[model samples]
Structure formats: C-alpha cells, structure tokens
Target: MAARKKWYSQGLRFSCTGCGYCCSGRPGYVYVNDEEIAQISQYLGLETAEFLSRFTRETHRERSLNERPNGDCVFLDPISRSCRIYPLRPRQCRTFPFWNSNLRRPRDWEDVCRTCPGCGKGPVFSYETIEELRRVIDL
Candidate 1:
C-alpha cells in the first residue's frame, strides 16, 4: 500500500528570527550527543570533561544542556535573546519546529507556529527535508 501523506507534505516555511522563544519560558531538554559535546567544548575552548561538568546535566541516562533558574536555555543570552553557541548547537536545537512532536498533526504545527515566529516565514522546507530532520530527534 502507498504511504499516508502528512499534513505538511507540501512543505513549511521557517527561518530563525533569533527571537529566543524556543529557548526560554519553558522547562525542556536540549539533548546533546558525544560529538556535539566535543564540538561545543572545542568551540568554547574548554576541555570535554569541563564542558560536560559545567554545561550539561544527566537525565534518564542521557546528557542535556543545563537551563537557567528561570528555565531559559543556558546558551540563550537574556539581553540579546540569541543563542550563545549557535555555531555548534546540538541537533535538538538545530531542528526546531521540525521535531516529530511538532509535525505529528496540523494542530501541533499550529501550536508551534503560535509559539515560534519563524514557523511560517522564510524558505519553504520540503516534506523530504522535514522527514529527514524529524528523524534526527524524537523531541
């Protein structure tokens, strides 16, 4: 049988406005793998162990970036409202609004659009691209 088409099969537009909405005002995990951790550590000029100790916390046997007391991502600059480590941000951070959770239904995408200003702006991402990104992380 043929596969079912998704609500966003045509595509969706998104371009990060650097608004920081996805990085703050909520308690969530920004998971990082070993390679990402290493890259971020080197980018910050810190040893891997030091970076892990200072910037990450273990939860459910996985490593996640630490959040500020108010639930803002640690890398989010409160004054600038931009990511401090954008160059080497984790896969989870890089795949915003394309996660499985957000693409599961039209309603879910709408909710994402409400919270993320970039959701319906900029270049259109094809279904193939969305599926590739959605497979990167479950979210």
Candidate 2:
C-alpha cells in the first residue's frame, strides 16, 4: 500500500542559525538517558555522579538536563548562546525541529518556525530523512 502524503512530504529546510532561540525562553525537557549522561560527563571531565548531581534533575521518574531560573538550558552559554557540550549533547538535543511534536501537522511546524530561526533556512530534508530523525527521539 502506498503511504499517505504528509504536509512536509516535499521536504523541509533547516539549518541551525545558532541563535539559541530554541535553547532559551521556554521551559521544556531535554531528556537524557544513562548513556548520554555518561558521555556528557566524560566530555566535561566530570564523574558521572557529579555530572548528574550538578547538571541534571529528575522529574516524573525520568532524567533531564537542568534549566536556568530564567528557563535557558543549563548547558546554554549565557554569553555565546551555544551548548557547552555540543558534541556530546543528548539525542533529544541532536534532533531539533525534526521532533514529532513539531512535524505532526503543518500548524505545529509553523509554530516551531516562529521561534526556531533554523527552520526553513537551510538544507531541504527529504521526508525519508525527517522520518528517520523523528524516530531517533520519540518526542
């Protein structure tokens, strides 16, 4: 059977402009698993336990990166507005704008593009690529 066409079936453009808009001004989860915690800890030269204590918080029995009082991600540098642990960032962080919540419908994608400058600004991601990314983190 042929698959139904989605609003973004033609593909979507996205290239992180690094404005940090997505990283701040909103309180949301950047959920990380045990393996991600370990990698981020090693990248920062901190012990796993120390990293978890200082950078993560538990809510609803799941672990996620901490956010600043004003709602910026803890790893978001106040000055540069870039992630401190970009390379080892969790899978959730790696998949941005491609999240299911954002791609579920055209309206959702429109909402995301409003805040995320990266959306509609760069390479065109085919539906196949977008679907693959959406599967990476069940967001």
Candidates in order: C-alpha RMSD to true structure: 1.0, 1.0
**Deviation in Å, model 1, residue 36 alpha carbon:** 0.6
Give the local distance difference test score of model 1: 0.92
Off by over 4 Å in 2: none
lDDT of 2 by residue, 36-82 (tens): 98889999999999999999999885899999999999999999999
CA error at residue 8 for candidate 1, angstroms: 1.0
What lDDT tens digits, residue by residue, belong to model 1 across residues 1-139? 9988888999999999989999999898999999999999999999999999999999995899999999999999989989999988899888998998998888999999998899999999999999999999888
Global lDDT scores for all candidate models: 0.92, 0.90
Pairs that clash in candidate 2: none
lDDT score for residue 26 of model 2: 71
Q: TM-scores for all candidates? A: 0.96, 0.96
lDDT, residue 104, model 1: 82
What's the number of clashes in each of the models? Answer: 0, 0
